[model samples]
Structure formats: structure tokens, C-alpha cells
Target: MLVGDHLGRVETEALLEMGRLDGALMYCMGAPESIYAGLALRQTLIGALRQEGHAFTETRFQAWFAGLTTLSDDPSHKARPPRAVCEAILTELTHSAWPVLARTAASLISALLAPHDLQSPDAAVELHTVNAHARAMVDALGAAALTPLPALDALHHAVAQSTVFAAVERAEPALKLVRADMRSDPHQAPRWAVEMLYGSCLQSAGALHHPIPLVGLIRPDTAGDMEPGEARIIRAATLCEIMSTQLAMLAHASRQSKRAGALDTRSTSRAPDVLALLSGFGAMRSAQIERVLKATRLGVRGMVQLLLTAGEIEQTTVSGAHLYAVRTHPSDRLGITAPLEEAFSDDAMDEYDASMAQIDRLLNNAASLQR
Candidate 1:
């Protein structure tokens, strides 16, 4: 079922043996349109090739995989490399490529999916979910590489994270395929394959992310005759790789949320204009403020608390929830200064103010004495 099974074994062995992973990949991609044949020959070819110490180098493997994705065959095209090949390629990248492949794949996949997700929700949701898991796995792997010496547990943890997330994402396309089939003919439903696909996805997710053995998620009823364990393992790995890079983005969001909260505690803590935020929303609940300002619950509460203490905002219970509102609009108070200004009571502030005042008084006293 490979793209070019018509090529004799001599061609296959020669190209694969000569560090021509792309050529071999091309041949595999062009083989007869049969899943079983394509998958079997690919496993044999990849395994035999790798065993000969001609594994696709990290840089080359990534380029080849990225190119194939653009070849854009029918989604159901069975001749293309199975998801397993992608997973193996990722594993190779993580192990041999190190920082380069991990970073490249992470950036590339995110860039590719960003537009697709925006344009299509169904596809985007699945892609994002998979990305989350894959990013987690890759980070875990990358973290392991920094160790004094690479250890099995570290690698295993990394690989496991990758596999689980990959499985989740790969399931997205498979799920779409299944639903399309079921919709076309509910009676002729490819129940077994459909169930197995989802089961496999869930199983990998459980093993990689959660403590659950995901085997229970395996669906026993699909006619597609999918091998649940093997399928789940492969899918999981793919999802893990995509998600690995995304983990950084997730961390970034958390940090931004924290910063927003700090600003809320004291408007002076903010790098951006706090007056703009206050003007935009005259009054808001803590939760709403957090959402609008991208701050965490703690951050919002802290900011509101500071405002309350400074008499800048008054808090009132409304419908069993706390609300914060500006005590005086900045525009209205622009022409007037508050009659009462709270002074800092901290020893540091006191010392600083005292020093400045003493300097001013000395200058005044010197002028008077001279006069």
C-alpha cells in the first residue's frame, strides 16, 4: 500500500541505506493505497533502515515530515506514512536532535495550527487539546536532557508525556473520520474502528497525563478492526510532541495572570496605564475584573484590597459577590486634589520623606540667615 511498492526491494534498500530517508519516505508515501500494506512495509523499512545506523537525522526527518503534510492527499489516503512514523520521527528528534528539533517542531506545529484553528473550530479545538498534551511531554523531555546524565526514568517520563498528548490529538482526525462515516450510514457504522480509535486516544491520555491505565477506554465494538494498544500508543506519542511546545505558552499565560493581579493590588504596581482600565470599566466584580484584566483570583483580590485600604475604591456585597468601583472618576477629580492624603507609615518611607524635608528646611533657614 506504500506510494511506490512498485519499486523493487533493491531500490528500497539502496535509498534507505544511503541516508536517503526522504526518498524512502517518498516511495512509502506513493505506495499502493492500502493501509495494511503501507503500514507493514513502512515498519519493516524504517526498522531495517534505522538498524543499519541510517536513521533519519533530526533535521532531515523534520523537513521530510513537514513536506509530506503539505502533499495534501485525501484525508483517508491509506498510502501515506501512518501516524506511527510521525511518532517515531518525533522520538528520534527528542533523543538525537535535542533542543533544535524540539524547538523547531514546537514552533512549526503551533504556527501551522494557529490559522487552521481560527478558521475552523472543530479542527482547532482538537488540535489545541493535542498541542497542550504534546507540549507538556516535550518540555518534560527537554527538562530531562539538562540532567547531569540522561537517565531512563527521565526519558520515560518525557516519552510518556509525548505519547499521551499525541494520542489525544491524533484522535481528533480519527474522530472526525468516524463521525463522517456514522452520519453517512448509521446502520453500516464502522463501529469497532471508531470505538477503538477513541478508546486508544483515551487510554494514552490516561497513561501519559493521569494515573489511569487508559486500556479501559479501548472501544471493543468498531468494525474498523483497529488494534487498540498499538494504535493508542502511536496516537498518544504524536499528541505529546505537539503539546510539548505549547506548555511554554501555558506557563506564559499564568505569569501574565499573576502580573495582572499584582497591578490590581496597587495601581502603581502596573506597568501599563491603570487609569485606562478603570475608565473602561466603572464597576466590576472580582471575577469579571480578573477576566477583563487577565489576572488570577488572588491577584484581583489583592488589588481590590489595596484600593479599599487607600479609599480609592469601595467594596460592597452585591448578590453575595464582592464588587469594586472607583470612588471618584479620574476625569472628574482631574481639577481637584483630595483634601486628605494618607501618608506612608512605613519606617523606610518616613526616613525618605524626613530626609527630603530636612534638606528643604535647611535651604530655607540658610536663606533667612543670609537675609
Candidate 2:
């Protein structure tokens, strides 16, 4: 039972083609609604508080809202909000002598719940009962001179774990969506698509200042599902392109150092090219290094061990494979750094931004539905 079937078949297919079905499903899982509710509640509460002659800056409101919603973390990332932050925000909200804010928050929660369709009349009665309990808790907090943290925490959890929230969560996709940390996983289709798109952008721009049109790659016609081998190949090609660019930068730095007499020509001449390769390519397995340099396994292993002992390189395991990369040093000649952003044409960036806005609108519309 694809959730997209209930939302819109064509829209779901479009998300799937873009390799963003997981993202779309997750978005529909009440995140947009939660964000919208939090923002609207904050605005309403602030207005009520101001009418009561309470003083607070927008910055303070932003901080409090961020703490409450866990938006202080990277909002672009899809991770759940931290419990500690939520608890702290609740503690503050409940303990303060701000009855207006508490009442407004309770009203917003009830209003937000009204849109969700329940299973039956009994379910609807149960939802109303939950809302009544929530309102009672807020009233108690407002009446008290100081509400305890535990009480606030309990109230926060009750609302979060309510039947309405569960219903919304159940509507989202069950697939675990890929994140930035999962970029190294060659099996993830989204990662491959992103890497390929980035590589294409790099090749086209020849520099790294302009914005990359990542949305341009999410075409329904072009973005058919990627096979595992295809993903691997794409990952390799992207890594190779990045390494090649890093090597050029290293060479440029080496030339500069040599001209400045900071680097000895004799010493560099005696240094194996493998050092440059490792420094340029970043973390790589022995087989990968050997293949890239066309060197013997034993020779590469010995070089890697020697570099490890010299503190010029380090090894770490990722996804059950040992990988090696150059270590940072004060005296290191090559100051190679990865290009953080891809350069894109102005027209392409504008188009990408528009496409992203359209996608957001679709996702938001889908999220607002109870069915």
C-alpha cells in the first residue's frame, strides 16, 4: 500500500523518478504540519502575549521556537528533534507566568487536531478527550506559580504521542531515507544521482563559486531507478573527478612551494607519487590505491604502513572496509581542500530554485490532507 496512491499517483511517480519518494513520504509524515503548527502557534502566542503587554524580541521568540521544535539543528536534515531540547522548551513555557501563551498553545493544538479525520465517532471522541486533557494541563500550568519540568515533559510527550500524530506518522513511507552521512554508501540511489549531478556541474562550470542546480537532475523521464553496479560506477567516476581536481591543486601548491624555496626539489623528487595520489584521492582501500597507481599490493601496503608510522596518513574503517587518507600537518605542503559547492549557470540556478519551490508546494499540499 503505497502512501502515494492516496496522495496522488502522478506526483508519487514523479517523486519516485527523482529518487525522492522516501523524502516525500517522510515529509508527508506530519513534519510540514508540525512545522506549520509550531510557527502558527508561536505567532498566535506572541500576539496574545503582546496584547497582554508582555515584552519579547523576535530573536527570543525564534530561539524559543527553535528549542521547542528542534529547528536549531540543520532544518534541511530529516532527523527527529532532540527530546532534551523539547523538554527544556516545555519547561520554560510552562513555568513562565504567561497564561496567554499557554492558552494560545493549547488552542492551536486543538485547532491542529480538528483537521485530522478519525476512524469513527468513537475515535473522534477519543481525540477530543485527548485535546481536553491537553487543555486542562495547560490551564493547570498557567494557574501554578511554577510548573515542574517533569509535568511539562509529560504534557509534551502526551501531545507528541497522541493518536492524531500517530495517524499522520503511519501515512508516511516506512523506508529509511538517505542522509548526508550515508553519501559514501554506493548502494543508495539518491547518493549516486547527487554525485553524478555534482560531477556534471563541476565539469560544466570549470570552477566552484556558482550554485549547483541539483533539482535539474530530478527529471521524471531521465531518473529511472539505478542498479547497484550503475551506482558503484557513478560513485567511482565522481571520486575520480574530485581526486583529479585535487591533484591539480596539489601540483599547483607544490610548484609554488618550490619557487618559494620552502620545499626541497631533491626531497620531492625522491618522494613516491603514491603520496600525492593518497593525499589527492582521500580515504581509499588498498586495492583502489593499487589500481589507481598501477602498483603492486605489497608495495602499496608497505608504503601505506610507512606513511601510517610517519603520521602522514591514517586509516579508518567505513562500511566494513579499511580506508586510508592523508593526515593534517602544520608543515604539509599541499593544502588541498574539497570544493564545497558546485558552480551553475544563473539560468540553471533559477530554474532549480523554481522546481524546488514547486516540489515543496506539492509535498505541503499532500501533508495537509487527512485521507
Candidate 3:
């Protein structure tokens, strides 16, 4: 929770020296500049421990791991693993220490590499050393290698998901390109390509805060083209979307339950008020209208159904969010002449132009008097 503690001049110099050497190695390996800084810090700590020649233990490993992660915004607290302490712990690390160090470095690499897609060939190369170190640690630990810390696992999972979500968003532009290609030559757009588009759209919908069921949104044309991978993606997306929607709706309903504890408001009598409100607001969710009307859940549901049946209101879904809006009437003409009339009154405009012209002449004449 605390920010890193200050290291005295001597200790800081030593740490920086180790960091510089490690940074050079990282740069030579073509890793990102940020990763270079992180690796340098890790190397510095490891170098210090190796120099000290202290016996490494699980408890000591955990402590060191926690120290490395102690960075925070608060300036008052010292870094969790004090710089002086780390320097003191510096010694030659033993074979027993390799497993802990490998795991710890893997955790750091995971954090550093979170924003990048691990599937990329370039990313794989960037991570090769970190992965190799982790493997070596596992081998050293033999059959007794400790499981990854829960916090590290959680961080990795979140970053990985976020990367996937970003890819899904970017897929739209590519999909449009594919569509254009398919129009020119149908075979150019394979079944897998279409399925990828659908899957991305589906997953994108599910990633929303209040996701709605996307199964209904799936186009019949695309569904049949889905391969096993695409099918699995769609299935997961559908389930997640439905679950998220249900949870959001249920939470909204629960909040309304307290307000609607006493349904003194009449259903039939208040139906017109609800319709007028919807008309004025343009579009709203059921929970929003319920709160505005102070009506019971059942009452609102019944009235909404009636309005739907009467064709007075219609529902539309946009990006997994349900919205209700009043239907436009066929006879309702748009007022096209109002703006034109306001902007141009023939006589008034002529008079204004003449007055401006007179003012300009008077100003020019007054300039001669001043001279």
C-alpha cells in the first residue's frame, strides 16, 4: 500500500548500477523500454541477494515478492522492502532460490506484458527469457514448486481479458474490409472470417457493464458459417451477456422494490402519464420509467405490455442496452419552414442592411473631422 522507500546514496548507487547492466541486456533482446526498467530493478534485487549469500526460504521469497510490488501513490510510507534491507540481503543466490526468483520474475513479466497480446510472434520472443527463467525455477523446485500467488494470478487474468476485449473492438474495421472483399468475390471471405466477425461482436457486447442477451442479435447468415472455435466463442458470449443483463435488471428491480413498497398509484389511471413521460423523454429503460412514475414493478410491466400491444411505443436494442421510445406517427410532418421564416424576414432584413450601410458612411465622414 505504501510508496517505495528512499535508498541512501550508497545503496541507491549500487541498485542503479545493477539496473543499468540489466537494462542493457533487455535492450539487446529487443524488449520494450518499460520492460527494461522493470527487469533492471528485478536484476538489481536478485544480484544483491546473490552477493549476500543468504539461505533462501519460501517465507523469504514471499517477502521479497511483496516488496517488489509495494509501489503506490502515497509518498509518506517507505517501500515495503526497504532499499537498505534488500542491499543487506544481497548475496550469492543458491539453486533453491532459482524457483522462487523464476516465479517472481514470471509474475513481473506478466504484469509488464499485460497490454500486449501474448499470441503475437514478436511478443513470444520478448517473453522468451522470462519464460525460460520460470521454467528453470520450476525444474529446480522439482515436484514441490509452489503454486502462483493468488494476487499474481488474478492480475494476469484481468490483463489477458482486457487484451482480448481490445482486440474485439478493433475487429470491426477489419470486418468491414472483409465485407467489401466478399462483395467483390464471395470466396475471398471465408466462413472462418465471417465467424470471427460475429464472435468479436458477440464478445464485445458481453463486455458491456449491463450486457443484454446477444443470441437474438446473431444474424442467421453468419450463424451457419461458424466453425467450432467461433461457435464456442458465441456460446460463451451469449451466456455471459444473458447473465450480466439478468444481474443488472435484478439489481434495478431490487432498488425499485423499496420505492414501490406501497403501490397507492393506480395502474390504469397512471398509464397515460407513463406514455406521455416516455414521449417527452424520447427513450428510456424500464427501470428509469418506473422510478419516474413511482409505480410497482408489476404495474409498470403490465402498462408497458399494453402500450406495446397498442403500437404506441416500440423497443430498440443498441449495443446490448434495451431502450423504449415512442413510435413516430405517419401523419406527423416535420416543420421545414419554421427555421427559414425566422432567419429571413424580407422587410426587416432590408431595413437592417440599409442601417448598417448608413452607419458605415457616417463613420467614414467622422474620420475626416478627427483628422
Q: What are the lDDT scores of the predictions, listed in order?
A: 0.32, 0.35, 0.33
Candidate 1 on 1-371: residue-level lDDT in tens?
43223222223232222222111112221111121121222233233223222335422322233332221222222222223323333332233222322432232222121012122444334334543554444344444344211221233333334333212212234355466444431111111111112212222322111111111122222113455334334333333322332222222222222333444343445322222233222344555455545677786676667666766666655336555555654423323322111112255345545554654575457446755
TM-score of each: 0.19, 0.24, 0.20
What lDDT score is found at residue 106 in candidate 3? 37
Among these predictions, the greatest lDDT belongs to 2
Flag the better candidate by lDDT, 1 or 2. 2
Of the two candidates 2 and 3, the one with more favorable lDDT, higher being better, is: 2
By TM-score, the best candidate is 2
lDDT of 3: 0.33
- Model 2: per-residue Cα lDDT over 172-287, one tens digit each: 33445955455431111111112112322332222222111121221112122555334333333333333443333423334322322332234533124444544432345666
lDDT of the structure predicted as candidate 1: 0.32
Question: What shift in Å separates residue 111 of candidate 2 from its native position after superposition?
Answer: 56
| Candidate 3 TM-score over all chains jointly | 0.20
Worst 10 residues of 1 by lDDT: 207-216
Candidates sorted by lDDT, descending order? 2, 3, 1
| Cα lDDT tens digits for candidate 3, 1-371 | 11111112222332232222222222221112222222223434443333223235422332333332222223112111223323221211111122332332333332221122223354334233323443333233323322212221222223223322111222234455466434431111111111211212222222211111122212222233455344433333433343333223222222222222223446545555455544322355565566656677787888777677767678766335456655655422121112111222466445545644654465456445655
